[model samples]
Target: MPLAIVHQSYGRFGGAERVALAHFEQLRRMNIDATLFWSGLVTPGWQTRLKGYDIRTIPSTLPTPRNLATMIRFLRELSRYDSIIIHHHVDPLLALYLARNLGERTIWYSGSMFELAWEKWITGEDYRSISQTVKQTGQEYYGKTLSSLVLSNNVFDQTVRLARTVDIHAVRRYSKIVANSKFLSRFLKRIYKLNDTPPVVYPGPDPMLEQLSSKDFTGEGDYMLAVSPLIPLKNVDGMIQAASKVPSARLVVVGEGQDRVSLEERAGMLQVPLFLKGNCHSEEELAMLYSQCMFHIHLSLYEPFGLTPVEAGLFKKASIVTDHGGPPEIIVDGETGFIVNPRDYGMIAKRMKELLSSPELRHEMGQKARKRVLEKFTLERSAKQLLAEVES
Candidate 1:
C-alpha cells in the first residue's frame, strides 16, 4: 500500500520542509507510491519536481480555525489514506484524533522538544484561557479541542513538563513515534513513561549542500554567520554582545522573525557590528555566504539537531555552537568546531576570536567538519534509515 505523508503548511522553506522534500524524493526513487497532503500551496519548484506524484493541498488559514467543524472536516478527509505519517509541524493531538477513527496504522515524526514549548510561548496569550477551560472541563474535552502537539525546545526539564501535560495515551495509540534525535527520544521516554524503544531518526541536509561545494566565496569581509530565526530563545542579542568584544569581526544574521526589529535596535544600542541579512530563499546565495564566512555561530538555547552546523560543515566551514542538545552530536568539540555555554558571551567571543586569528586551525577544523557530515549525516543515509524503520 502507498504511504500518506501529512505535514503542516507554514512556508515552503525551512528545515522541516526540506526534510519532507528529501523523503518525498527518496520514496519516489524507490518506486513507492507516496502522496503529500499539506495545508498550504507548494512552491513552483517543488511542484515541478513532484509533477507525477499525488500531491494535495487543503486550503486553510494560517492559524487554522479552532472549531469542531474544522476538525471534523479534516478527520473525515484523512480517512482515505491507508497509513498516515505526520511530521512535527502538524498537531499531534489532531493526528491522534483522526487516526483513532481511521484505525491503528499511524506514524509521527518529532524534531525537538524546544519546538513544542516555543509554539506555546508564541501563542500563549491566545490559548491560555482556552487551555484552562478545557482542563476544567475534562481530559476528553481537552483532547478533542487542543490542536498543538509538540512543546518547547529550551530545556530538558521544560520538555518533560510539556509532555506530561499533554495526553500520552493519545500519542502512544499510534503505531510509531519517531524522534529526530537521541536526546529528544530520551526526553519522550522520561516524560511519557514509555519504554526506551522509540525510533530516533537524524535530520539530513537539503540537496543544496551538494551544489555548495562548487560555489566560490567572493564575500570580502571579516565576519561570521548566524542563520536562524531572530527569536528570544535563539539568543541573537547574545551574539551581538559577543561581536562587540571583537571590533574587527562583524556578525551577519540570515533570517526573519518577530524579534528582528528588537534585535536590530539592541545591536544599535550596544554599538555592535551586526548585519541583518533578513531572509535569503536562494540556495546559491546562502551557499556563497556560508563559503565566505570565518565560521558559523549557533547560540540556540536548546536545539534538537541543528542542520545549519551540518550545512556549514558541508561548506568546509567551522561552527561554534551551544554546548548542549544535538550540536555536540555533530561537532566534535576541538576537532570540528567549538561548543560553548549557550549564554556565555565572553566564552563565545573568545572562541570566535580564536577561530578568526588562526586560519590554519579553521581550515583543519572545517575539513574535519565536512568529513564528519559526509560519513554520517547525509540524506542518503537518513533515507535508508527511514525505509528500514518503515519496512521493519
Candidate 2:
C-alpha cells in the first residue's frame, strides 16, 4: 500500500516524533512505499535526524485564524496516498478536516486527545475538567460558544472546542483509531464516548538504541536519569522533591522546556545535585545515559505512553514511573520497576532508595525489564502491527 504518515511537527524530537519516524522507516523497509508529511518547524538538529527520509512540510495556520487555503493544500497533497495515518491531533482543525475528507483511508494513531490532556497541561487546570464538563453538559452547551472564545485567545482548550463545534466527531470520521498504550485506549473510549476500546500499538525504543546496547559502556552510576521535557506536567518539581529526600542521589535531566530555570532554582533551594542537559538530540548520548544510570525515573503527569522507560528497558535498566497514566502500563509494578503515585514524593523517594541500596535488586529488575522490552516492545513488532492494522 502507498502509505502516508501525518505528524503535526518536529518542534522537538520527542517520543511522538520518534515513533512517527520509526513507523515510516519500518514500513519502507517492509517494501511498502511510504512518505511522511509534517507541518511546522523541523529543527536543524531534527533535520539531521531525518536526513534520508521522504519527508515533506505543509503550510499550516497552527496559531493563526483557520484558513481554507491550508485545508485545500493538505487535501491536494494527502489525497494521493492509498492510506493515511495521523499521529496526534495537535492541529485539530486540520486533523478534523482531513479526517472528514479522507475518512475511509485515514487511521488516527492517537497518543491522546488535545483538549483532554494537553489543554489541561497547558492551562494547568484540574485534570479532565473539560472532558467532564462536556460529558455532563453535552457538546451543545460547551461547543456553541467556542468560536468567540477561540478568537479571543489562542489557548488550546478553545481551539479544540472550536474545531469540534464544526462537528464534534473528530475520531468518528477516521476509518480506525488506534492508541499507543492500553491506558490511552481506555482514555480515548471514555472521553470520545466510543462503545468499543481502540486497539493499542505500543511505540518502541529507538532502533538505534538496540544497536548501541552492544557497545562497551561503563558501570551504573549513583544518579538516576530522566529523559523528559523540563515542563510542569512532567513533574520535574516532584523529581527534585523526591531527590531531596534520598541522600547522595543525583538527578540528571535530558530535554529542555520553559521550566528549566524554575527546576534549577528548586533544586538549588533544596540542595539537590541536579544536572539539566538540554535536549540530547543524539540517540547514542541518550542510550549511554540509560546504560550508566542506576535506574531511570519518569514521573510525568498524564503521559500517554512513556517511551523513556521502554528505552531504559532496552539498556537493561529498570524505571520508576508514575501510576497516573501510560507509564504504569509500561512498567510491571515491583517487577520491571515500581509504579508510584506521581504526587507522593515520599513513595517515589522510597522506591529510589530501595534501588540505590541494592545493586542485586536493580540488576534483577533490569534483566526483567530488558526481557519485557524484547518480548513486547520493539520497533519491528510495532511496525508490523501498524502495517497489519492499516492493511486490514
Model 1 CA deviation exceeding 4 Å by range: 10-12, 41-48, 59-82, 113-167, 217-221
Per-model CA lDDT versus the true structure: 0.71, 0.78
Best by lDDT: 2
Q: List all candidate RMSDs to the true structure.
A: 6.4, 5.7
Best candidate, TM-score-wise?
A: 2
TM-scores of the models, in the given order?
A: 0.82, 0.87
Q: List pairs with backbone clashes in candidate 2.
A: none
lDDT, candidate 2, 251-291, per-residue tens:
99998876788899999999999999887867778778989
Write one digit per residue (lDDT tens) for candidate 1, span 51-89. 877777643322345665666676677777667777655
